[model samples]
Target chain A: GGIITQTPKFLIGQEGQKLTLKCQQNFNHDTMYWYRQDSGKGLRLIYYSITENDLQKGDLSEGYDASREKKSSFSLTVTSAQKNEMAVFLCASSKDWGANTLYFGAGTRLSVL
Target chain B: AQSVTQPDARVTVSEGASLQLRCKYSYSGTPYLFWYVQYPRQGLQLLLKYYSGDPVVQGVNGFEAEFIKSNSSFHLRKASVHWSDSAVYFCAVSPNYGNEKITFGAGTKLTIKP
Candidate 1:
């Protein structure tokens, strides 16, 4: 079975610092996504890449940027960390672009001091 | 403009009891619905999905969900829940196929009593 791996399971950043989260999937999926989950809130999509170098903005993409350098990897960047901000960033991928099943990574918890 | 709503924030049920969690969605087109489970500190796992054919779909761990298109609701049910069923459940909806962003509900925390 293929796996989606996320780096730095726990991330601690200082206020105003830039942070980066990386995701790699061995499934060779064509579509990848980044989402943020806040306490007591549903997951919000930040960015998605349909293919290499392709980017799409989701509802919550204001402070985030994403890149798909290759077919198997997608990365997310937080422009600037905010104090007292804490959330989990999740990475997911699907074999196809349309409504298909998605496989997810374990997620990275971010805490800004 | 698509959204999903899970009315219950938390539910407590005794082991071996039947369980049901309510989920409502708002979308203009034919909706694609899904139920996902998340154990403590774990990633979300797809339990079941509904996309046009059968209204009822069975999933892992004896879980099932029935989609009521008329009511715009998809409710998850389990004949007999176990302690292992304790987790957070999320309901999600997407407007159309292909690379569309899915909207998720706030989630319901299920606590199975021993």
Candidate 2:
């Protein structure tokens, strides 16, 4: 059994500040993903990595940058935090690309002032 | 692009009663559908998924979802409800042949009443 751990469960950033969220998974999966969850918008894919040093943009990757330096970890950076912005960032991993089981981290709640 | 629609924004059910949550998807080719549950202050967890084979798939915690290709719907159902079942449910689809990128619905918040 493995667990996906997300650091800084709660994040607070000033408007226009840059923030980074970290995720670590011991599952040793080949794919990792970052998703943003909003009040009425549900979960939107930010970015995903198929393997180490691989990256793919999703529907909502405009203001975000993702890194897959290591297979066990993935990180997301917010280019510029917007005022009154609030959302939950979730990290997930999969065994492979095809019809695989995805495991998620607790998530980082972001709030901007 | 593949998309999902969860028509119900919120649903409330009494304890020990039956439950059903609606979901609809749009895709050009063979579709892969998924249902996920998010408990309070937690990340979303897969309740069940449909790739091929069976149309009615059983998921965790006595939950089941039926996929009707004609209607383009995959609705989740449960025979009995518990207070712990209160959570937000999301329907998702993998439009591409593989699971590269998935689209999700707005989600339906389920509240169980005792």
Candidate 3:
């Protein structure tokens, strides 16, 4: 079975600092996505990549940027961390661009102070 | 825009008791619905999904969900829940056309007491 690996399970950043999270999936899925989960809120999509170098903006992509440098790796960047901000960033991949099943990574928790 | 709603924020049930979690969605056309479970500090795992054909779909851990198009609801249910069933459940939906970006509900935290 393939696994989705996310780096730096816990992340702490100072206010106004830039932070990055990385994800790698060995499933060789064609579509990758970045989602944010806030306390008491549903998971919201940030950005998605259909293939290498392809990017699509989701409803909550304002302060975030994503890159799919390779088919197996996708990364998310927070332009500027806000104070008192805490959330979990989740990475998911699917075999197809349609409504296929998704495999998720363990997630990276971010804390801004 | 497609949206999902999970009315209950938290539910407590005793072990071996029947379980039911409600989920509702707003969509214009045919909808693709899914139920996902997330254990404490763990990633979300797909429990069941409904696309077409059958309205009822069975999933892992003896979980199942029934999609009622007339009511725009897809509720998850289990015959007998276990203590390990304590987790957060999310309901999600994707539009039938265009992009496949999924919209999720706020989630319902299930606490199964032994």
Q: Mind giving the per-residue lDDT tens digits that candidate 3 earns over B28-105? A: 899999999999988899998988898999999999999999999999999999999999999999987636678899
Query: For residues A3-112, could you state the per-residue lDDT of candidate 3 as single tens digits?
Result: 99998899999999999999999998999999999878989899999987789998899999888989999999999999999999999999978787888898999999
Worst 10 residues of 1 chain A by lDDT: A94-103
Residue-wise C-alpha lDDT for candidate 2, range A1-113, written one tens digit per residue: 89999998999999999999999999989999999999988988899999887999978999999999799999999999999999999999998875567899999999999
Superposed on all Cα atoms, the candidates' RMSDs to the truth, in angstroms, are 1.1, 1.2, 1.0
TM-score of 3: 0.98
Instruction: Write candidate 2's Cα lDDT for B16-75 as tens digits.
Output: 999999999988788888999999998889999998998999999999999899999999
lDDT of each: 0.91, 0.92, 0.92
Clashes by residue pair, model 2:
none
Q: Write the per-residue lDDT of candidate 1 for residues A43-103, one digit (tens) a residue.
A: 9889999887789998899988888989999999999999999999999998878677888
Q: Can you list the residue pairs that collide in candidate 3?
A: none
Tell me the deviation in Å of residue B29 in model 3. Answer: 0.7
Candidate number that wins on lDDT, 1 or 3: 3
Q: Which stretches of candidate 3 lie over 4 Å from their true place?
A: none
**Model 1 over residues B1-114: C-alpha lDDT tens digits?**
788999999999999999999999999888889999989988888999988888999999999999898899999999999999999999999876544677899999999999
